[model samples]
Target: MIQLKAGQNIPLTGDVVRFGAKAEAALDVCALVVAENLTVFSSEDVVFYNQFATAGVVLAADEVTITLAEVRADAKAVLLVVSADPIAFPGGAGLGPVTATLSEGDTVTAEFAATPTAGETALICLEVYRRGAGWKLRAVGQGYVGGLAVLLAAHGVDVDDEPAQSDPPPRPAARSGQGVPAMTGPVSGEASTVAGAPLEVGHGVERLWMVFEDAARSAAALVSAREYAAERLDHELSLAVSDPATRNTPAAEEARRVAQQRNDELIATAEHRHQQDTEQLMRELADADQALPPALASWDSPAWDKPAVSSDGIRLGELYAIDRGPLRIPYCVPVPLNRPLWIDTESTRAVAPVVGALLARLLAAAPQRQALVDIIDLTGAFSGFTGLLAPVLNGPLITDHADISARLQAMVDAAELAELAHTSGAFPAPTEHRVLLAADFPHGYQTADAQRIGALIMRGDVIGLSTVIVGTNESDSADTTVATLSQSCRHLPTDGGTTLFDPWTGSAWQLDLDLLPQEPERQARFMRTR
Candidate 1:
């Protein structure tokens, strides 16, 4: 299940969902059907203890159920709300901490916690709203000091002046003209949301990550719909043949045919919807790529035509599906990277281009003289990038084993000093972003060198340093320290294997590795700008 923090949101999976509330004391649960203006047109749209069901919303003893497929066409959102018992505690006591759960049948899909302040009597726990072709659930956690009457009046619901225990926090109020505050704004030129997660407006790297997340969600939804269709078809067919009286009969045959046709139609509809979603995301991706500040854009992106500026991330590659036609999303990771990057493969020639592209992107992400590089090639594996990076290197490229040891020791010391200064505030903290490009690792290194390398890999981000080590993990002994450190790094295969799992959904995505141009002039042109 996805645990949602306050102000976070995620895409819903199925049409029929249950929103349940659990608290120390019994709280009143309800749902309000609202329009795009976030106001209820009529009082009948409110589904609560008194009006138990309306517009596909059902409020039970402990939960509120919503059927997305049956919701009214004019409704834009369903607000899941929980209020404290005013009758039980008339002094406006808080609801303490309430946990809200969203489930599809028996499986819990997502959850959020709503903690009301001392005087707040009602809380808007979740918002199940229409987002594009699908729906999404956002953790609102918006509370009110004035009770359920204020909540209803805020959404334009007229209150009755009758005393009723069934009404949630019973109180009368005149209808209000105000609406709930909008929780989203624009990013770039479009709405600032990705897979229902709201984003900071105008940040290109965040936008890039958001687009990638959206594609992952879209892809996952397609797979789920297809599987559900197939399962439904199978279940219907089984029912048709289960009874011996109907087995092999004309009626059974007709049932099977109808079931198959419906299944095919569902699959087709799902595919069409998925295509629409993908196309929309692709357009957004293109817009985000064009706005990227040269650091997060692809090699051919228009952003590269402009001057390089400091960025918070580095674009490693593009993710695409081999079977899903032409949809491709840019994949990037933040820098001061959290994990060391391991360009893993056996072929020396295959890794050079990837390393070159990465170094170029990293250099472009930082301002002039702020990003430093140290290249160590024991077997001349990464000689191809030397000329391009010669002007910015910390020193001459070290090809000897002893020099590799000395370089690793120096980086370790730098990391230790920087980390110490950050905590102790006794010395001037290092401001430069150091990057180490070590190729042909574990070939000529001793145990002490490997240990030093391990320390650097583990604490690189904390010290404003990054490591892009090229080597194969397949042949390393699993029990060794080098193997342990290698496993800690983010492995990007240099061979033909391109599948990488997304952090949000763990969905496998095919990464199209960014390769630098082979022309010397083109490579030099990129370096000249830095």
Candidate 2:
């Protein structure tokens, strides 16, 4: 049998060959048929112990055998990799010191031990390939620190969609003098017992200790030598210093001065290197933080109110804003039932369709025929919501200036009556609510109508009478608060300044809104059933 060390190879003369191994943990054997260009055709071409459907490879416990019959003619070589895990190779955990190519018919056997400092987990254990009409076995002990997945990805296998797997942290760098003893001289040289044989005289050790003067002087020299060696070679060097009398000579004193100067230079170099490393680490940490998705810093804040479903169709959308992270802050505007929802359309043409959809959704979500809707489409942009509103529209669509005035006065009168009824406690608050949707307000409203409209906005919330005013102009009254929708799907209050509300993140984000689904038939059916 030929004993194969790492990076060794031998000729193969047979049609089939068997491999065997003994390991402390379970091992997986995989084979890849590589081409001249070094690219894999597909993930399916990789054969592992668990998936052995490849034509000529047979896998079993501790060994795998490859037959020559099924290897493709265009294949350059078969690479054999051994791993400890199924999903990923153990990075830094080494493998295999094996024997192979024992005579033509003999089986190959391999044994592997874990590394003292596992520098890699997955290793290219062997390679079987054609060598001019004959086969050859090569022991390739190259290891991958990133494991099998990384190795495969490097060769163009698409593993981007694979589930995230935890990777082993990189081995920490050894600190100065770790695991190494202070050496008085060369580690391989003969041992010496002379006290002052290893240290040079009179350079940085005059007062190394506070104890006995003679012993302290000797100890200081030794300490200086060790420090000098560690700074230069990254490990303490063993050296034999001569007697004190010998070291006190002129030549020794000069050598001591030179060593001290060199040691100082090394210290400066080390400090500079350390500063660079610290800066690099800080930058990497900052990049990692930026890559992570934003999250809430605290869930207990009052601004993070929970959202509630509105029975009336005035539920515009959820609000999203950014605080410590992206947060889903509730949109607290009470519409259709309480407050007037004024949507300013100057910034966005999409406001009309969005408002239409909101109205349709509210109508569809309402219980039975308890909610009423009236449309005054001054801009004639309510066609998107017309199918859903057709079944429940309170009156013929009002378009004239006089008609809008009359509608606002009627709502005011109704609200006053409802307020009187509510105060008297004659009956429970009415379940049926009226919604006035006045599209393109102020454009078709006279001064009298505007005053009436302002009054409705002021008292509509308390009386179960609400108005949705859609217009391009800003309202003059504080009671008529306005929310403007931008073309980018940013919802901005006229008074709220630059902050834009994102409905999806429930936070203030720069993201545009996703188009609301337009299901006219479903909405129409819902309105009819209600």
Candidate 3:
């Protein structure tokens, strides 16, 4: 073991190294980066997700955090080699032991193992990524592109050079004495582009780079996986390795051998993480096994239990349907507000005759019927439905007439429950019948034509309908008749500016008299008439 102080950033030379407790500047042993919010972790080695802790650190270094969830280095010397930096090389290929949520200059210093004297700059291309599982590594390339795409797409990064297709900096050669090769003296395409201009980098060039990345990853993975499979297949187990007493006996030797084998296996697993890609290895292992795990097998297999789709009924949400309830309900005639219907007070009274027909309808909210029927009275031109009130945009905006009508109907239906509370002749129990007041409703919700309202009044349930009157000065014969009817019935103003006059007992006062408060003008007229 390399002898350094209790807390240091120096690289340990030997593979066999250990850390003590938190007090001794030793953190817990774990492969994943952990912090409160992101305890499990999204990406490891270098912390991501604006949370989670990085591995291998001194107490003071680890303790210093900017956010509640992450740690930061105080000294600028320690740094992470991210994908964006110009100085990336043998370093930034993967996450380092330390990470920060937002980008910052490195605070602490780091000492990497001595660089090998070998080949061209060591490459660290995008590998496998996390989609289904947490972060999983892709096997070195020349393999499955679709699988890799699935993994990396979520991170907003992809294994393919597709990302590089946008602008990327010139490739930095493995750090030489000449400060990370600058693109210019190096005349790099990514470095020399004019602002906002098309990035001078070409796809042909990126494809060439992919060729290298794909081959290298694939080759490295193949070698590592084959070796691991061979070693694991041999199958050995042991307990002790170096005890003298054990060395003497075959059983002892076997135990020592097994111990050595396990150690080798552990090393192999670690190597699989660093050298070959973990994803490729797992895929290879599964391939060797030939069948999926029971869970995945059942999952991937076709499901016959789900019901089949049908094209039979009215389409809703989508273009498909399945048999729902036992009631074989026939379609209702839809009064789609395809065109503009006048919506003034007068138009209201004119249409009242039609609405009167609906009075007998088994309004689900009938007990609260007065409120529902009156809600129509409550309606003033809502600005939200203004453009929508037009034939084109009408009923499609925030306050669709559909909703308006439905709410009015709902209020009436809800009143039904209240009506159940009282059996007074004033509020009759709605019968099982549904009423249609479309008589003379001319094509759509058009202006309240005298002929139209007249026809609906004669044929429809006049008592139940609502008659809307426009123009404060004078109303039509219908309005005059309704206003006169108000003499006998109970009239209550809905929350909206209008009031309802219901017909009741006496023909002399056919409209309910409760609405006396509703009309100051009529109250004045009564004095004049008297």
Q: What are the Cα lDDT values of the candidates?
A: 0.72, 0.46, 0.25
lDDT of 2 at 57: 66
Q: Which runs of model 3 end up more than 4 angstroms from their true locations?
A: 1-202, 210-241, 263-530
Query: Across residues 1-530, which tens digit of lDDT does each residue of candidate 1 receive?
Result: 97665544567889899998888788889999986446786999999888899978998877999999888865768999998756665665667788999998889988887677756667888889775557888776767666687788778788775323222332212122222111111221122223323332235556576566566656665665677789999999999999998788999999999999999998797677678877787777677666777777767777776776777678787788776547888766666655777887776566787888888888887765376789888778777658767667888898898888888898899888777876787755456778888788767777787789788876675566778878776335654878777866767765555456554434556777888777887787565335
Candidate No. with top TM-score: 1
Model 2 misplacement above 4 A: 1-315, 318-337, 347-349, 461-463, 473-498, 501-508, 511-516, 522-529
Worst 10 residues of 2 by lDDT: 203-212
Error (Å) of candidate 3 at residue 231 is 15
Every model's TM-score: 0.65, 0.35, 0.18
Check candidate 1 and list the clashing pairs.
none
